[model samples]
Target: MADLPNCPICTMPDPLLAADGYECATCGHEWLAAPDDGLDDIRDANGNLLADGDAVSIIKDLKTDGKAGGIKVGTKIKSIRLVPGDHEIEARVDGRQLLIRAAFVKKA
Candidate 1:
């Protein structure tokens, strides 16, 4: 048997292959498998590719809602974690966890 990919919606590993596409048994989700084209590459503001544990610096000052202060430009962040979703970078700032968009940071 051929190896099947995990469901994109639920992350289930046992999606069954169907005539049209793959179907997730756990979540009842169906999706067509596309070729892996490196579309998920996360790039910084300087167009540098970012990876987990890579250090980065904020390129722009960002405001925090209901917070006393905001992230300043050139603030350094170490050991960044890459996460899925709109905000791709996750790091700790000022003792608080923050989800930052990759566009606001640059490789440091």
Candidate 2:
């Protein structure tokens, strides 16, 4: 049998490969096959895959509404958290939590 990835939802070792995707034997969960290594679906401005706890730098200046000043280019952010949404990254900048778009950053 071909090497199949474990179930993503249940972490089952034995997942049955189906025509559409994979089905977990233990939890009966179904999910589509991962694209490439599947380390992360998020990518930086340079197309580098971003993982949790990675450091990134802002490529462009971003202005925040109702706040004086803003995030500037080349600002380094460490220990970023990957999130699911329109804003794909979560991090703390200057003691404020910010949700950042992937296109504005590059892996540092």
Candidate 3:
């Protein structure tokens, strides 16, 4: 069979394939070879790669269109969907679907 993909965490070559996905032998970290949606790599403020369903926190106060008081600093946002763009995070907060910049958030 073809070689398995490298581990995302430790960068170890060839994690073994399993029913769920691949698991790193060195770090024991398990991750899928690619996301189901086929979106490109998504990174956070600290440059940590983000995956779908990742929870992130707003690092600074961000003004939204309708909200009189904008989103507060340290607001926890869950289930973020990464899209393809400069400001490329899709999330729902306070009943509003918002497109947030990755620079303003860190993995929660």
My TM-score estimates for the predictions, one after another, are: 0.64, 0.64, 0.62
Write candidate 1's Cα lDDT for 1-108 as tens digits. Answer: 888898998898999888878999999999887655443799999899999999999999999876877999989999999988788999999888999999999999
Task: Write down the lDDT that model 3 would get.
Answer: 0.87
2 or 3, greater by TM-score: 2
Q: Which ten-residue region of model 3 has the weakest summed lDDT? A: 32-41
Clashing residue pairs found in predicted model 1: none
What C-alpha lDDT, on a 0 to 100 scale, does residue 54 get in candidate 1? 97
Instruction: Candidate 1: list runs displaced more than 4 Å.
Output: 1-39
Error of 2 at 100 (Å): 0.2
Show the lowest summed lDDT stretch of 10 residues, model 2.
Answer: 32-41
Runs with alpha carbons beyond 4 Å of true place in candidate 2: 1-40
Pull out the clashing pairs in model 2. Answer: none
lDDT of each: 0.90, 0.90, 0.87
User: Across residues 69-103, which tens digit of lDDT does each residue of candidate 3 receive?
Assistant: 98999999999988877778999988889999988
Q: Give one clash count per candidate, in the order shown.
A: 0, 0, 0
Candidate 1 yields a Cα-based lDDT of 0.90
